[model samples]
Target: MKKQSLVKGAFVLTLAAFITKVLVFSNSIVLSRVLGPEGIGLKKMVMPFMGLMMTLTTIGLPVAISRLVAEADAQGNRGKVKKILVISLVITGSLSIFVVSLSIFSGKYLSSFFLTDPRSYNSFMAMIPIIPIGAVSGVLKGYFRGRQTMNPIAFAQVFEQIVRVCLTYILVQRLVPLGIEYAAAGAVLCSVLGEACSLIFFIVMFKISHHRKMKISRPSWSQAFRGKNVLIELLQTGLPTTGNGFVISITRAVQPIVITKSLALAGVSSALITKQYGMLTGFVMPLLFLPGFINQSLGATLVPAISEANAQNNLRLIKRRLNQAIRVALIVGVPSTLLLYLYAHELMTAVYHAPTAAPLLKLIAPFFLLNYLQSPLQSVLVGMGQAKTAMFNNILARCTNVALIYPLASNPLLGINGVILAISVGVILETILHYSSVVKSIGYALDIPNIIKILVAGIAMGYIGRALFINLNNLTSQGGATLILLTGIVFSIFIYMLLLFFLKVINGSDIVRIPFVGKMLGKIFPK
Candidate 1:
């Protein structure tokens, strides 16, 4: 089988992710308006718990499946691929069933204690069915990703988002007259149907694909199930990945509870607490993560790509890919950080209709750039079979966050700002650790000079663009402010590229490194 180029795969996935993010962002905007802050807060509060349940059900099998399948595909072992899929499905499916049962049985206790909002009880219960449906879709996604066939995975994601946005909007609007809790429950219910839609799409795509007709003999239950080897391999790879996920999910699940409880103890009212939580999670964090879709797409493509290269013991290929991934991350992430820092207020007001999100967004913008880079570095570590090291680093970060969050959030002077500080500190620390681990594993030196150059270029572009926006803002009304900001953003990107060329941070050679546009750029920026 011919391998897909990393850039091509990343581009495809990035396009899909961009669309998905837009749709989801739109859904969030509509839902926020329909449900209001309290309703949105109710949903956000249960998200961490739902994420924890998902982590428990998946047990990181998706990563393991992708890595194992990539290795098997590299070796042309079709039967092994089939067996790996079978084993993974059996394991995750059973775990999913267990999780759903547990959630249904423990909903009341979870709502009363962990959530502290009895109104969130129905939303918590609504997440039960999503676990199993999402688990099945996740496995299929990993399978397609491992095969380096990103189209199906891309299609499934976009399709899922479409279904989710439409359903969530419809349900939330219909249920809003009942109560905010019912509306929140409607939003959660959308997740279940969305996953089911994606799963069905994957199954249909898989059935029609050429791989389904491959002439490999199916492994009997005895042959596939008899050996501890497959189970051991799965556990070895999946456990550490799952451990990382489990720790993060635990912290996430605890964060809202900690924040609300701490704020309440600090004399903040319950309603205000929920509204504040909604602003942070629903508004500010989304803006901080806007550039993440690019890195996430790159990271998703990196795993199977790196795994395949590692399996072949191609050290040079691994180093080259790592360098490319880091450079691309910096190129995109640095400008994003600067843009968000400069335009936080404008963006918040424009996208979320929440001017209050500006302060938190500005506070976290620079640190969030490190968070963006962490995604690819962690992916590289997992791809290089250093998942245990990655897991340890993540656990340390989460533990640190948990230890400090209450103290910071409960402090009268700090409050929610303290929570943001804790998060920023955690992200920076984790990124450094992940980067160090990747360096140690690969024995490749990162290009710090180039990174510095990118940062310089980004800062220069941000100031210049800010000046232009300020001049333009005087001429535009509130109705056209978003358009002007968007126009400025476009100009900012162009200015960044121009500065990159002028500063020699990016030249014809760098331009030629891009996927589809490389040839066009080469012609335009001849060395």
Candidate 2:
């Protein structure tokens, strides 16, 4: 594809991604308010199961389909595309039914094993029927992504979030008055509804696209379906990344079990545990992840591009694209990290109305940056066929996390903070290990000098932000903490960009690469 086509495609997809993220973010705020800590905590308790189900149902299928389609197109074997899609459909559909059945029969036991409160059992049971919808949707979405037809995929994302949020808000608001457990279950019910809507949307788009393509050259369904090549191709590309997805899901599942058991050992009340978990992971971490929507949007675009280049043995293009992705990640990651560090408390107080969440946000801010870097970087590595190294690093990190969390939280001095600290340490270790592997494999450093320059700029911005907010807090009594924080955030962003431009930290070429920065940079710099 031409550079123009690539840019246009990425832009449309990114817009869809950003919009969907905004919708999800808005729902996060709404859910937090309606559910509070207990309701949120209940949801968090069940997250691991949901994550695991998602991984099993969709993880390998999407990766396999997208790669097979892209690879087939590159090799001029158009017949393989349809074959891969059909095989993916059959495989994923079968897995979805099996997984849903397993969940239905075993959800109560799974709930008891993970969640101490048996009341969450029904919620787990409720999530079963929705699994198949999500499973099939994942395959269709990947097929579209492979074709580089991203608009439909993007719209489906937005549609899913809208449906989920609207339904959950009504259910939770009405049912919370009845009880928190019911309210919590209502939230899980939203997932079922969202998945159904998304599946329908994907089917519609896939048919339309497939219909147009079929008119030009039709291959017999039997001919497309009979080839053994489809199975081999999907397994070859998809299996390695499947481990990465499973590890992530499993690690997330372990978190609640670890934290809850540890807190119990410390004699903390169950009620308090729920609140603390909600405050830390729910309200705080999500805020820290707000910037990730941007990184992920870019990452989705980079995957196919990187995969295609690598398939054709285009090393120079791979490096160029990798560097470009890293640069973009740094530009957003550095400033976003500093901004969170500087104003975490103020931001939390403004949004969640929970002053206690401020400190938790501070503890979790570094991980946000680490994740923002690691997520896309890891995807790039996998695209480059380095999934084995990525898998090893993640496993090592999770193991280290499990070992350290227990001992650290057991210490009387650290208490609850120890758990948060453990997560940060584990994340730092994971990032280092992943970076080391990438550096060794690629034989290049991560541009340390450029990284330092960006970090310095970000720190300078943070300092200015702290000073402005400190003063603003002293002066404001009307709009309260939220307004003061908002003012500081706006001022800090403006000042940061002005400094970056003046210092030539972001040059002409870099300016043109960003989504909207080009037009603004043109006005300010006057090309």
Which candidate's lDDT is highest? 1
Least accurate 10 contiguous residues by lDDT in model 1 = 215-224
lDDT of each: 0.83, 0.74
Candidate 1: Cα lDDT at 152 = 85
Judging by TM-score against the true structure, name the best candidate: 1
Q: Over the full model, what C-alpha lDDT does candidate 2 score relative to the true structure?
A: 0.74
**Model 1 over residues 266-325: C-alpha lDDT tens digits?**
678889888888999999887777777888888888888888888898989888887778
Give me the runs in candidate 2 sitting further than 4 Å from their true place: 1-14, 25-50, 101-129, 165-193, 207-211, 214-226, 260-278, 353-360, 474-479, 505-527
Instruction: Score residue 426 of candidate 2 by CA lDDT.
Output: 84
lDDT of 1: 0.83
